[model samples]
Target: MSLQFDIDAVLDRLATDGWVVIPHAMPAALTAELRDACLQVWQQGLFHEAATGRGDGQARRAEIRSDSVLWLDKVATLPAVAAYNAAMDDIMQAVNRGLYLGLAELESHFAVYPEGAFYKKHLDRFRDDDARTLTTVFYLNEAWPQDAGGEIRLYLDADCTQHIDVTPEAGTLVLFLSDRFWHEVLPATQQRLSVTGWYRRRGGSVPW
Candidate 1:
């Protein structure tokens, strides 16, 4: 699998804007493979309704987030997943070199948002824990139309008065400071697929 994006460019934007969106970040072939792998596992009923919070605090809250997720840690042996992991590692190292964020590792999962599903506005970092430093999302839906309505609304201010909407298009990658942004997934007309993950510092909560 080939990673074709400019690391320096991405880092520059992350440093200045606290977020960056890249289209066609991965090769089409690799993106297709990853999408297929995600769908295959999902079809086998491997995905579970995503929950809110962590550990004992975690619970299914459909009103908060209505997506299904399958953590990548459980399927690391899959070729597409393994490739994606390697690519992430490369980017992580680049981030450390450029930003000195001290990101130790990444934890990720395939998130599938079915029709009429949505995630309410929220920050990625937990209220009591701040280990998650960076958030990343890679979209896998090809031919996604503008009217599909599965866009991610990223708030530009704490008050959430200003925001930008991002369409979930194939081979796109989005990165941002986990604790800095308030974002949400809008309800869609069809299935929306993505691999959502976070990079954490040492001694942070495990991704599982």
Candidate 2:
């Protein structure tokens, strides 16, 4: 099934607040299939420890981040993965039309956070690169309990004085300005699953 969301509402929210979270952005069937595919790759030990920075600066820093990741192909053979790509493409076009963001492409990955894993606060865009225009994270953990513990903490102010915690629930999609938000993942008590990605403009910098 195709993904569904309100473009007007999402655009309005982004313009007003710089970020928005949509519950049930994807259908249940699609969410389940994508979750299955993610688990299949994870069980096969295909994911690698997530690293920070780009190129020579890139290195695994367990002190800052402890999750694993498996990037998705731009054109995926898996039906569920293909559907997700299409959905994101739709969103990219809508955003460009509404906000004139000039978004041209998306790079995404399946991320798994093991028990007690966390990522420290950081901006999605690198200091040297500005191609990343928007950040999107789609959660696939079904029936997430209140105590699951892995929540994206979005810092709302430059001084980090205000914030919001977003639960990683199935079929939920969160979007925000890549260069604007300072966010982190709280340590999880159990495994956490999601697809994380960024939309890029035509010519700011190469992707890491």
Q: Please name the candidate that would achieve the greatest lDDT relative to the true structure.
A: 1
* Residue-by-residue lDDT tens digits, candidate 1, 1-208: 3459888999999999999999998889889999999999999999999999988999999989999999999999999999999999989999999999999989999999999999999999997778899999999999999899999999999899999999999999999999999999999999999999999877765543
Worst 10 residues of 2 by lDDT: 1-10
Clashing pairs in 2: none
* TM match of model 1 to true structure: 0.97
lDDT tens digits by residue: candidate 2, 14-120: 99999999999988999999999999989999899999999889999999999999999932788999999998999999999999999999999999999999999
How high is the CA lDDT of each candidate model?
A: 0.94, 0.93
lDDT of 1 at 44: 98
Deviation from native of the Cα of residue 9 in model 2, angstroms? 0.5
Error of 1 at 73 (Å): 0.8
- What TM-score do all the candidates reach, one by one? 0.97, 0.96
